[model samples]
Target: MVLLDMNGTFLFGGDRFGPNQDYASTYRALGGSRLATDVVQTIIQTCFDTLEVIYNDPTRSDSFPQVVDTLRALPAARGVPPADLALLERVIAQHELGRVPDDYAVSLQKLARSHVLGVIANLLSRKDPWLQEFYRAGVLDLFAVTVFPRMVPASSHRGSSSTKQSVRWGSRAPM
Candidate 1:
């Protein structure tokens, strides 16, 4: 099975880009304010809590100062969503290829040519719309299996002692 992590795997993610305009604008219509650092902080704290549960380690906490320092260093994230320091740290990492590796697409295409290609991923449901962005970007069509976490039920979350219960992937050719 060709398992791949989501986010930086097949999609361009991070705080540098604004939210899906439709969604963001809708939130605005509903009286949403500028995304605050606290919102970002809560996301980080949730990840840390999940990690703590996994490792059973309380000492493993995140450093906000370090994150802030790192965000200031990213050229693309300057000025917008100023509170995305944590997003900056998590999203910026070396991947199999640039942003979305060319080799990943090539390899998936090659694999699909002969074998049943599969992708098992741990994903968050709230982020599913971004998958469509990759489709628009022409990267989603290369996979035979694309797993996401939204498909899982609340009961399944405890099955593997992991926060994620299931992945949402496709058997159909990427569209």
Candidate 2:
């Protein structure tokens, strides 16, 4: 069996708000035209900032909230309707779940013939979107097991018995 991290391994572009990121355009493209560009940008930035806070703090790792829930709770999002909030969530997913190339799918197919493939990914959203992408790329069934674990804080797992045990024997940690 072969274990692999999803992001930056075979999957690319899940990180949001990089230097080249353009929140305004993504907002407009995702049916956010009703809102001002600056307003959308603020909401997007606020979401990113909120995620940063949760990600940087080890205590919050276990209970990391979904991006949509965080947005719905925000003062900036108070006036935004539920539909728009859903749209914003899609926007975030778009930026986070990067595309899979055709060649990568082909390679995975070849590799799966000899080795059992598994995905151990840390994703902020539900696995449906990622699963859909895998299906779209023609590699969904290639992976025998897929574990999308919640972001675990490094300090929490350091030298822990469970961590060592998990490394020795894989577990289907929830998505």
Q: Which candidate is the best by lDDT?
A: 2
lDDT per model, in order? 0.42, 0.72
For model 1, residues 1-175, the per-residue Cα lDDT tens digits are: 4555655665443323223213233333434456454443343343333433533433321211133343454443356464444333333211111244566556556766665555554332233444554465455655566654433444344434344433345555543
TM-score per model over all chains: 0.41, 0.79
The alpha-carbon deviation from the true structure for residue 154 of candidate 1, after best TM-score superposition, in angstroms, is 1.5
TM-score of 1: 0.41
Best by TM-score: 2
lDDT of 1 at 4: 58
Screening candidate 1 with a backbone cut-off below 3 angstroms (N, C-alpha, C), the clashing residue pairs are 146-169, 146-170, 147-168, 147-169, 148-167, 148-168
lDDT of each residue in 1-175, candidate 2, tens digit only? 7877888778876776754578778877877777777777788788878887886787755566667778888888888988888878877777778767888889888998788788887666656788899889988877767766553333445544343221212232322
